[model samples]
Each structure stands twice: as C-alpha cells, then as structure tokens.
Target: MSKVTNLNQFRKQQARVKKREQGSVNAEKFGRSKAEKALQESRATKERRDLDGHQREHDE
Candidate 1:
C-alpha cells in the first residue's frame, strides 16, 4: 500500500505560495525605501530653489 497525503493540506500550501509570490510582486511594484524617497524629494527641492533664484522681480 502507498502512503496517502491530505489533499486539503496540499491545496492550502499551494495557495500560500501563490499569495507569497503576489505579495512580493506588489512590494516591488509599489514600495520605495526611505532613502530613495528622500533623495527624490531633495532633488526636487533643489530644482525648485534654483528656478526661484533665477526669477527676476517685476514691479507692475
């Protein structure tokens, strides 16, 4: 006689693996590190400051 395994357990394990894969994909697509976000914000601030510095004051 051959050993019998629980089919429900196998299905649950398969579902868990699929969920784990989806979570990883979502994290990669939607996640950013703090340092990366900070760097982007820093660059944007610098650009804005430079643009403002170059603007001439106009009196109307």
Candidate 2:
C-alpha cells in the first residue's frame, strides 16, 4: 500500500521556494545594496566639496 502524504503542504512549500528564488533574481536585476548607495552619495558629496574648495572667493 502507498503511504499517505499531505499534498497541499508539499505544494505550498514548493511555491515558497520558487517565490524566494524569484525575489533574489529580481533583487539582483533591479536593486543596489544600501552600502553601495551610501558610498556613491558620499563620493558625490566629497567631489562637490572639493570643487567648491578650489573656487576663488569673491571680494566685495
């Protein structure tokens, strides 16, 4: 005789794994990490400050 199994639970588990894999794939395709974004912002700010520092001050 064949053993009884809960098919509904198995289907739900498989769906969860598939959704998780899809989420990871979407993240890689569409998103940057917080650290990377923060680093880029800081680099831009530093560049702006350096440019401002190099400018000659206007005299009245």
Best by TM-score: 1
lDDT of each: 0.99, 0.97
CA shift at 21, candidate 2, in angstroms?
0.9
TM-score of 2: 0.54
Question: How good is model 1 by TM-score?
Answer: 0.59
TM-score against native, each model: 0.59, 0.54
Q: Candidate 2 overall Cα lDDT vs. reference?
A: 0.97
**Residue 18 displacement in candidate 1 (angstroms):** 4.5
The residue-level lDDT of candidate 1 at 5 comes to 90
Q: Residues 1-60, candidate 1: write the lDDT tens digits.
A: 999999999999999999999999999999999999999999999999999999999999
The worst-scoring run of ten residues by lDDT in candidate 2 lies at 27-36
Q: For candidate 2, write residues 1-60 as lDDT tens digits.
A: 998989999999999999999999999998899999999999999999999999999999
